[model samples]
Target chain A: MTKSNEYTDSSRATVNRRSFLKGSGAVAAATALHSPAVEAEPQAAANVVSGATTITLNVNGGDHKVTVEPRTTLLEALRSQLELTGAKPVSSDGSSGASTVLVDGKPVMASTTLAMAVTGKNIETVESLGGEDTDAVPRAFVKHDAQQCGFCTPGFVVAVRALLNKNPDATESQIRQGLNGNICRCGTYNNIIKAALDVVKGGV
Target chain B: MKNFEYAAPCSENEVLQLLSDQSGQTELLAGGTDLVGLMKKMIVTPDRVVNIMEVPTLKNIEAVDGGGVAIGATVTLDEILAHPYLEDYPAITDAILGINSMQLQSQGTLGGEILQRPRCWFYRNGQELLDTGQISGGDNRFHAIFGNNGRSKFVQSSRIAPALCVLAAEARVIGPSDSDIQMIPLLDLFRTPRQEGQREHTLLPNQLVTHLVLPPVNGGLNATYEVRQGAGPEFPLASAAVSLELDNQQRVHQARVVLGQVAPTPWSSAAAADALMGQPLDAQAAETAGLAAVEEATPLSHNGYKVQLAQVAVKRAILRAAGLETGGL
Candidate 1:
């Protein structure tokens, strides 16, 4: 058996196995495969728009040419590159629902998806929820005091708008479950749920 | 977050070539729902991220030849929940829906959710096991109290894993070579941490989980139950997914009991499954199985409540799947 401290080629062979028992061969092979790539290529500059891949994204109704790294998430691309700050980065992780956007008519966390991955798909953000005339969800949000710190309102509005578009007559329970992913740290959940119900019931 | 080179390969062969060329330093990005968070937290700093979304073959959901389902690695959780064929497999769909939040379901791919890293506090907080001379003070409160099996104490994060385990799903992995396709049993996807190191079964730098194949549930009843502490968005304290295959005589033919948030991986108890086998899935059988499932639980100082909670979850899940209400049990 190879000592754990020493790197060996056999360790690389067992890379597929979940076990941590690194033999010499697997380590050597893994090292050989990985080391040369870093040494051969220079590190790419971060946040540089030049030399990045250009993808056509149809946001709302208009098309926008966004240059993004392959690793750039849809959330970052929209907020940083496109200057559409409607979808706030309240929760860096996808769980908070603060960065939610509609991709192909489905609500998803912009932070959890790669910008390049959604090429050729219909993408919509909070900016697209309301036409140039007037927005319904944001009005309901303001009327119901749904805006606390205002960081999570855009995501909530976008989520509720999508939910209503899918099921205009959605029940209160369905509305609750649909908006479960978007959290309100300020304890405005009751009002938020009421706002969604108000729109669904056609009371607003 | 450290800077890294990124590539989107359109084919499996191209992915394999990239993995072969940059094995250890390269990491595969599926949905980035989990990977991006970890990268931002500096938990896993890779030199290259090979995004696999551009690979068309890995993004399909097809009907298998043997009446089962073949879900590609890139199949989103939203697609799985909305698939008409998955309605018959209610247990998996229930688990998928239980993840509940539309944001995650939309962005979280089935493959990424299955392969996500653990949510252990120590691991997430970046506690170094080795004494790296940076900290002169010995403050081991978080590191010592909740740490399990002595090593890295990160808890597994995927809520769907236990459900998939009970369903006996098969994970197809594509490695550095064209001939490197390997099918790993879902049961072996997790490993407990050693006494002084990180948990095993964490995906290696090169391997990509390409697909998950779930066998058809002919007449099995399946259900999942989760207990969240305080109702905010967080990992479950204890969750259980149970599936039972019944014969024409109403006797249990085969059963699988998987409990999550209890151990390093989704814990599968043969004892629990054995307790219900050859017996009718009545109230008594389910109670006995629930108690048998947690017999080997080695709870930490603060997590002792998990043992009883886990047993109750298992019992409730089994009863729910069996379609029996425990009104007075």
Candidate 2:
């Protein structure tokens, strides 16, 4: 589709690495404080409902309440219900890993996880990274043209962001192991690695 | 995936009650990595999925009373990989590192990793359990080489099962009632599923695996080595986990060797362990032990190469455990 780097000079863009991390860290702390209050007194049978039930999902620092069938996966709910199509649903098995997302600051295969399982958990998708965070991973991805077909880019960006959040100083081998869950059919692994290293060095 | 009832219980009592009522119809969901894939494949369509991820007690890795470590059932593989205490258990760390993909390790739990369904493509296909026997054995390359004498040929595909077996880990199980708790040796956890109704492990329908306890590794050198088709994620063609207790002169005082992806269970090799006993873990001893590890292997037509691969894996694991050279040897 002739994709090009749209956001140049991302280092001077909206949020630098330090401020971005500080903002997210504040948000994470506030969320942690509010979590215990959200479920102080656990309900008895109210927690064990049958059939298609209404549930609350905390996604992207916001509360998303959706009524879904019990079999609905997080990937299905995000794409079909919430219309968050940034995370691609490549394979139902999740081995392709085009449905990668951050669950409580960890990279989880959303397609393989049930939506009901992540009731109070924080879910961050590629769509959630555009604000004050100004995630450098996506910019680095564009800088290197790490993706060709682009179907796998969102998942890679989210996966790389999660990896860098945990291990900003990840080595080359660690970087390869960290992002091994996501796949690129276009064989852009070397470029992807380069872009991730850029983000790690430039501070994501 | 088929529409089903879902429940996330907060306490152990709620979990046991739901499991007791549902029995065989309920599928306990941990990290949902394997269970969701099985559901998508229509292999297991449970009436209800009990989400046990929130169960407070099952998500810990702590030190037991002894010098051993107790890993809770819900601990993720990524947590285990990043754990500071894992450095002492090279067999475990190396075994988990051989898993290839970070996504599987991150999303997958210790309980889910060990209890994962077989990776046999034929088994995971849309064939019904009863109809699985109708296959007249076409392209049995990925099938079992050690446990193929029975109707089933699927090999267990766990990265940590063999390592846990060699380390003499034990599983603490909690049943429908608190009084029903039982401790089982890790090696006894697997058996050949001869019939459609039989599962790979002996856990009862109402029972839940709580923790895995590994005794203190006292002055033993251990490691896991695997042979795979590629650097990306593929089931190991053959793998070995070896633990050796050396005497003052570096002679093998005791050895525990286990092979994975070669049998219906984590195949423990007394012959290989015996071969290493009283012998220095040199190249000759490693080679002899490797050959002895596969002495009983009856390979399928296409999987005969797995025996040689398994031999190399055993040799490499032995060498790696002993802190010696492995590539040229």
Candidate 3:
């Protein structure tokens, strides 16, 4: 098994699943409430952020400890630090929506969100969608051939799950609008629409 | 993106003190939707980043003593849509709905939306803000037509600015010190920067927007209409917002018409409003107001198409506010 400190490629993560140290927990409370548990010292208030700080990020119901500076994006923390490379970094402007993840069940672009800002929130990523067998959404994608280059597949799957999770009986137009953030540059939109519509009809 | 220090200050005093004390550029990270992209592109490289997301007081959305509502600065766009009084403010809702991206609506904040930098193609792709030569000659179809000149031609990218301007919203600002606080009109917040150091907004380095007080509509009708190229995640080429009240005789009494995304700021069209005053709400009135709104518009070399789009947006917005069929797609 690869060491915990070392970067473990996700392709080998499934084989060594038991060796993983962190698992998702309910440890982080409402940290953003009115009296902060961690107070800013009066003297160090001005230069509080001197360098990299270690913080716990709850991703996919697992709390993984990682050291990150202010510049580290949530997408970086997931793909680089934890080696959950499911979310693709296709665009920095976040218009592609390939790096989308759910923060407290609301879909947000992981590339746009700072790792420091999303400390205690429950983050759900593409890795959390199901096991190696694939879920109904992925099955629908395969049945409809929703992907061309397969670069935008994982993001579309996660976004579709979040959309369905929020609204079970979403209309065909609603599905189209909700998943507009995720773009298929290869123009596999027709198939993707078919897959999303199939899922909306609850026929896997 | 350049590495920087991060501080999630506990109280408002600490936030202001840190802003005042930071010798270098300290950019406030509220929603991190816009600023993060700017930082990644090296458009704005702040030496220090103060995470204001965890600031407790800035998260509350409450109704004031009067019929108006005071929404906190950091409140997300999705939160605003879920508000109880959202139905009454169709102008604001329509503006927010124009931002079709769910991720953007979920993560973007109200304060950050108002202060968005120009999304000019030339400016964003490693050029100066006022580089008009590139805009005049290059792929300038998306460039501003209403406020274009030899200088800055980039349009204000905020979709919410026109809606708020029509509503006559008030902005509450606080910074540098705990006692430092002031309220100003939302329209007064923006300006077309003329110099190297001036910004598109009037806020100083240390000033922070705390909240916005949206005045009660008070039996007023308002709506927003935008002309877009696609239904997907695309910026509007031209948009308009109209707020008006009818007199006892069913004539337009008071009116405010503001155009969006076709100027440096929310272009308040007094001529359009004047065209509606003491006039009936009909297709002719809407057409007259639409024409009047575009009278001062000076479309650039490649953006003449935007003039017709802006005129139609104004007419549709005016008709939509009056609950009439706009006859527009």
Model 3: residue A11 alpha-carbon error in angstroms: 49
| lDDT of model 3, residue B236 | 95
The iRMS of the candidates, in order, is 12.4, 14.2, 16.2
DockQ metric for all predictions: 0.18, 0.22, 0.22
User: What do the candidate models score in CA lDDT, each in turn?
Assistant: 0.71, 0.79, 0.80
Model 2 Cα lDDT, one tens digit per residue, A62-149: 9988987888889988999899999998978888889999898888889999888888899999998776766788888888889999
Query: What is the C-alpha lDDT profile of model 2 across B244-287, one tens digit per residue?
Result: 99999989998999999988889888999999999998989999
| Residue B177 CA displacement from its true place in model 3, Å | 1.9
lDDT of 1 at A161: 89
How much is B6 displaced in model 1, in angstroms?
1.4
Rate residue B156 of model 2 by lDDT.
Answer: 88
Q: Residue B277 in model 2: shift from native, Å?
A: 0.9
State the displacement of the C-alpha of residue B20, model 3, in Å, after optimal TM-score superposition: 4.5
| Number of backbone clashes in candidate 2 | 0
